[model samples]
Target: MARLADYFIVVGYDHEKPGSGEGLGKIIQRFPQKDWDDTPFPQGIELFCQPGGWQLSRERKQPTFFVVVLTDIDSDRHYCSCLTFYEAEINLQGTKKEEIEGEAKVSGLIQPAEVFAPKSLVLVSRLYYPEIFRACLGLIYTVYVDSLNVSLESLIANLCACLVPAAGGSQKLFSLGAGDRQLIQTPLHDSLPITGTSVALLFQQLGMSFLPFSMSSCRSL
Candidate 1:
């Protein structure tokens, strides 16, 4: 099965730089950012982090979710990204905080307190399935927080396995197993009338010269 997501990214702020722009935050981690005719990485990061620390602001107390759609200039195909932004702060020692705060740059050194920063995890795909990707991210987040050694790339890969697409639809829509067949019974009220073109095509395939007839004509026959 192929992966639902083309790329998975985690973005976080660099507390040292307090101003706006790309330098304010950096891509903490990402899986597979190589060899694309028009990579969505730059635009994706810009959409999420351009204003700087917006995800971590007080307005976003709850988990924030948004979608970004961009057309690949080369292929002229659209790529969508489902992003979830929330607080994912790393605990740091006072000494580490001092180092990260860059005491050398500051006028006078002072004890640093615990830092809280906004982090965003994004999943990019060719299709738009926000609910599916959101659910997948929930599992990925659980695995991420629970295990320190867990690989993000592996997590995304496993997520793709669970969210594989089936004939352009989500796997959740399919209930059949391997070699299994499902009989779909439709009520006449719900069924659509067969068009003359369809009947003509069928007759042509069967090498029959039968002309198309309506239900009323058949009744009279």
Candidate 2:
């Protein structure tokens, strides 16, 4: 069976640190590490993941999301990363950075947002088309933010599953667990058609009345 995504990473800002070094942010969680290829990710990812670090200005809003593309020299495989940035008000009282790292090491769960810093949830894949993932990021994030039923781990799984076609006769679906569950439909293959109505629905899901031409303009492209 073809896999939807190669890696799912949750990167959060480390408030204790001043620079965007290796310790600048913590890799909160990653899925299916055993199946990872020989190439190491997120090693040079700091440069693209958090471009200018966290912003302290309340007047200027930071960009919510962006995409990163790079070629793996060793494997000669092209990779696309869809990073969705978000800021949440997290209450962390006396939670040491070391403790948070320890908890993640032990339970693979992000205990709390590092000192109320912003977070970037990244989805990396070999999918030829990056625009499809970028288009879906907002809707996916909106659903993720609004729903309390989905956890970070499950959200990754759901995102992975969304990249594959729904299970039917002769189609062997990728399984994250023992039982089967419903998944959101997100385009994966290039042949899949996207309609304007679907685009409108995606915008609707994101609570946007109309498309913002400033950020995304056909003329710019």
Candidate 3:
């Protein structure tokens, strides 16, 4: 298995795949846009698939691009924040006889109090990219008789496990196992501060490892 840093590097490249570009383009095209009234919140965020070794600060580097819009569902209210939807697709290549599509939706609701406001609601919608990618890959692998249900299940389980807090002990966090098998024992001290290395190490301590899901072949739409 590769280290977490390696995974990031590889995944970064995977974002450059041709199919990845198409997927991101589709996402941007499907994004819902709305007019903004001078607010602190970002109106939208864009995605780009740059070439390997591309520098972010380089002048006129023309990287591949995709954009997402965050719009207020209720524009009449001044305090209501916008909701965000992330979209992307994965294409598995192989000789599989049939196409298999697995769709999963996970939603997180955050109370307005959590954001230090009165009655506000925040909803986060996420799609499991790696799981979806792996499933497609497994479908391709099946074409060669190299796929196993157990392996695919393990991959999905691991991908889901990745969503859990990366801490040793915390009552607020979800625990995957009982007793010695418990992976997270605490709440992550710094949720956003936590690095991919820290996450990979946490998983390593729990007897699991990760491999890079390369997206180098993906292109920008």
Candidates in order have lDDT scores of 0.50, 0.52, 0.25
lDDT of 2 at 152: 46
After superposition, the stretches of candidate 2 with alpha carbons farther than 4 Å from their true spots are 18-23, 38-42, 59-63, 88-116, 161-221
Most lDDT-accurate candidate: 2
TM-score, model 2 to reference: 0.51
Given candidate 3, what's the lDDT at residue 89? 28
Error of 3 at 54 (Å): 13
Name the candidate, 1 or 3, with the larger TM-score value: 1
Off by over 4 Å in 1: 1-3, 16-23, 37-44, 49-60, 74-111, 148-151, 160-221
What TM-score would you give candidate 3 relative to the actual structure?
0.19
lDDT of 3 by residue, 27-97 (tens): 22211133223332222222222212222221222212222223445552221111221222233332234
Tell me the tens digit of each residue's lDDT in model 2 across 1-221: 33566667767766666654444666777765654554455455545677775443223245366667766756555455645454655544424443345446543334554333566767676553354555445445655667745454665676665445422212223333323343333332334333223354455578776555432321122
| lDDT for model 2 | 0.52
Compute each candidate's TM-score over C-alphas: 0.52, 0.51, 0.19
- Give model 1's clash tally: 0
